[model samples]
Target: MALSEAEWKRRQEEEDAEPAYFGMTWGEFDRLPERKQQETRQRLSQLGATHVGFWKDCTLGKCRRARRCIGFLSEAQYKAGYNAAYPPCARGEEPRRAKIYYDGICRLFPEGDEQPKYDGRRKTGEEDE
Candidate 1:
């Protein structure tokens, strides 16, 4: 499906700062190169900081900057969502910021399009609530 104009712009803004990945099966991410995979590891590292330490380096100052990050799902998240079964990263690719799949978006998780929340509420008064 075609993305809306605003949606296109938002994706572009995040293209550099916060990492993003299309809905891909785990098998696809596993096949990527090491450098590409390393980016996810870095994001996971930062995710660790948000919980354990007060001081942490911002990988990117803004989600727009983080958009360039290659952060993605490991075995767990992908397995939960993806329909097809695939082996996990066997190259010993370390864990990543499975928490922050998208930068700055802490609560959102990819449960297919159900989580994206693009559609309007069922009723008009629901907008206020």
Candidate 2:
């Protein structure tokens, strides 16, 4: 996704201010040798934060419909929904967002859709007051 110049500047400033990965800016982290990056990732993976955190962050920020439908679902259930929503991401497209998948998830689970209203009318089976 292409970010506007203002957004890009904001993100750069934010990253510069906050530590990313292991006490370094994301740029610094990226500049590390691939082996070092892999090592850090492996350590983060053992802590159960890398992949899980990434997806949760994505869902909360970018997948509004998917986020709304997340109520009352177990981790496994949510994962199933996510897989159904983002097959390409499941296949191997890690850390990428796609509008198509977002739409797919919304279609698969319409919890975010507006609810219907019922007029205050009595049914035939009910006793009239």
Candidate 3:
């Protein structure tokens, strides 16, 4: 059924009020320091080079083990390894590092806001809230 204009406007406002992932929008991601952005892009590109193909194949139901992939052993398995190998930031707390890295990777692709939200505590002085 079609909604009235008032309902539609209210829904739009509610969506707009929703918090962004890691409390950051694409605009904020773009405004990060150039060095940080470059580093993030580089890390994401390297990750994509190594894993994107496999991930795509698995997601498209083209992999033999796609159905078996689950829980802690799922796609995040590679992410954990990547995080350990690359280590997003050297000077921040775990939560902050996770947020930065998560946001960094999310911003690397189109429709990034549709990516999963990073679940972590906000750093004391960061703008995330």
Clashes of each: 15, 0, 0
lDDT of 2 at 40: 59
TM-score of 2: 0.28
Instruction: After the best TM-score superposition of candidate 2, give how far the Cα of residue 41 lies from its true spot, in angstroms.
Output: 0.7
Alpha-carbon deviation at 15 in model 2, angstroms: 2.5
Per-residue CA lDDT of model 2 for 1-129, tens digit only, reads 999999999988787767667577877887788656655543433223222323344334333344322222225644554432232223224443233234343344356548668777766755653
lDDT score, candidate 1: 0.41
Clashing residue pairs, candidate 2? none
- Quantify all predictions' global Cα lDDT against the true fold: 0.41, 0.45, 0.43
User: For this target, which candidate reaches the highest TM-score against the unseen true structure?
Assistant: 2
Which candidate comes out best when scored by lDDT? 2
Instruction: Give per-model TM-scores.
Output: 0.26, 0.28, 0.23
Alpha-carbon error at 16 in model 2, in Å?
3.8
Error of 3 at 72 (Å): 27
Q: On residues 21-83, what C-alpha lDDT tens digit does candidate 3 reach at each position?
A: 356554555667854554454444334322322233233242325432111122353445533
